[model samples]
Target: MTDQIVPDSEHRGLVARLPQVPRDLAQLARFDRPIGWWLLFWPCAFGLWLAGAGWQIGLLLWLLLGAVAMRGAGCVYNDIVDADLDRQVARTAVRPVASGRISQTLAWAWLGALCAVGLIVLFQLRWQAQVVALASLALVAAYPFMKRITWWPQAWLGLVFSWGAPVGWIALRGDNWEVLAALYAGCVLWVIGYDTIYALQDREDDALVGIRSSALRLGGRVRGGVTVFYLGALALWGLAFWLLRADWVALLALVPAALHLGWQVASLDPADPANPLERFRANRWAGALVAAACYVVGNA
Candidate 1:
């Protein structure tokens, strides 16, 4: 049972302690990997902070809950839709759905339950935020099929995952569409860059199974591709800050995050199997740095 756990699970011990059924369910939802939810939540923070909403503790916590629930639900749905493909991928073969530890029926049930939690979080938001949040459902539903039809599925994931920025921004205020657009665009590129790094882990397996990804599409130039995406993200974020406040000091807030992204790109080693996942996980901190920048620039 312990050996069945995924290679990237961060809470193997706690997950291992659970009984078989619950453990499988937890793995199905990727609760063992909190990084997914953190990545989802940070963009919400970026939107809120950059909207000049100062430390909205209650709303932030609610958004955090939504991120965890919705991200889990998204994973469950993805696994169900991609069960056959997942089985062919070495790293994903152990997934509960792919391994048949959980039936599709049960997986759908669990997905509904997780979405129920997201529904509760939805009710906490204003009507505009609610509408903005609900509008992402179509993109989320279509995301699972993207890998089959498109080499750049990460771009679709970007649209879905970076949605919280607009929701958070609209939740606070309806003005400043330009700043919000810039922020959201930056988030989309950031997701593309990080998710491309993540796709490096499955490039060979993906090719074998006919699954497409930006990493596979980029071939030997993956490092340069990710560099381009990251640079675009930073440039858009800088534009957002300038639109919000023309002061030169506002641009300095992004320097730390810029340096962090630079480091990730500089040290990236796509040849080593382990290096890509490490770099991908490091984006959690990168997200934090960007959130801090958002707070400083928005609040200043």
Candidate 2:
């Protein structure tokens, strides 16, 4: 009944209508906040499109399902690990696990169900892609502890979230390792940038709880930090395009996404509570623009 369940839950009305257990589970998995899955899904699409498999709707659909399930699973795992910490933070205090609305045993069961779906998605991919996807498990497992140990947990997240790039590339063809590296690195910087914006919502709370984040680390200079990361993302993505096609026109495809990132940085207002979340949520569109650019270059 409170926003504490999720700060940016989009389908609150629908979620409110669900049964208590289902609602709690939905809240736990963040189904009401679809942006998490959207963010996860985009890199999968980016790698697929940029690897010349953009037209493989079947594969893309499978990856989307995988993203939804895996992102949910990751959140559940994170909440389980951070329940104590979440209780100390305003934004996450009412989460199912943190607030005791859902027991950890049940939460673990929920996690298993989500991972089951992820497993189904995994079986749909080729062995090389499957291996690439599975390699992320260790990263995922270690991510919840990063904030405790490092100021750059977002960097760890960048690696985990952007694993889809290589998976997509390897799914179609195993060659061209440089292009995949560049694309994956670009996605990593993009994750760091957008996630820094998302972290702004929790900076004050994070600091109080001793949780480190790029938002808290950058303090007043978060906007500038984001600008630098976004610029780096564009540069690396351009490098990926050039490596693949070596055409000036191929680089032009990134212009739309570049302008969009510029707008995000220009309009960013970290002091305003709403601005960071709005800018953060807008990245679904940014991801789409980047994917389109990838398609133009990779499939041209």
Candidate 3:
């Protein structure tokens, strides 16, 4: 297959992230970018903590590694499917596949390699967790086509990206359906909120390319839509705590995260796409705060 990653030669300020792109295939798997992995891993942490306290640190570490590998694998798979589209997006044009840094065949090989690592991590989980984990493959496989078929591709992303939450509960208790459902719901809404912000950055490109996304769907109502989703996330999280015994302290973390999301919306300049991307990426801190809440509640 032809490579489609467009190369940009403007080397100034933040435009230079590509200059230091890792040469090693391993690093190119993007283990260096912890945010993607952190986003994936957070739901798992919350689930594990909610199931019970004092999780094995080593198990958590392995899950982090799993998150890194699986997220990279997912990105590679997406690049393969959307290489042409990525070539057209300013923020994605320099991606490895779009820039010709990685060929299609090599990308497939790398994808398989990452899956192998993912498989090893899966093996470390309990039988129930393994089963829950395998159930996500279909969601992940269909993710690339979501934007083509639905305005809310980010909703589909929530399902795939947050599958770790279900596995987290299974990894610990194997049952407790209520908590699992609540966790999954919270994660889904969380993804929609942040991913809508992410989609804002590509609204023009997506419109030109005939891709659908929440950013396009919400349009001028992005702040309103994001507020709805963020509130939904908080609600589901509250439900999870209620199902898990409504630990009041766990609800406390929602304050800061809510304030942050509120600030993101209130101060949002949707016309300025960069603001949305910055706000979207800032979810790392939000995830951390929620994870802390779970740890405190679970441990308490």
Q: What local distance difference test score does each model get?
A: 0.96, 0.92, 0.80
lDDT digits (tens) for residues 1-300 of candidate 3? 112212211122233343433432433455545567888999988888777848668888888889998998998888889889878877677677777777889889999999999999999998989998999999999999999899899999999888888887789886669878988999999999998987887888889979999989888898999999999998898888777775676678568778877887787788874687678768888888777767766667
lDDT of 3 at 27: 34
Task: Residues 51-164, candidate 2: write the lDDT tens digits.
Answer: 885589999999999999999999999999999999998878889999998999999999999999999999999999999999999999999999999999999999998998
TM-score of each: 0.99, 0.98, 0.89
TM-score of 1: 0.99
lDDT of 2 at 281: 93
Q: Which stretches of candidate 3 lie over 4 Å from their true place?
A: 1-28, 247-250
Residue 272's lDDT within candidate 1 is 92
Off-target runs (Cα >4 Å) in candidate 1 are none
TM-score of 3: 0.89
Number of the top TM-score candidate = 1
Rank by TM-score, descending?
A: 1, 2, 3
lDDT minimum window of 10 residues, candidate 2? 1-10
Prediction 1 global C-alpha lDDT: 0.96
Q: Global CA lDDT of candidate 3, please?
A: 0.80
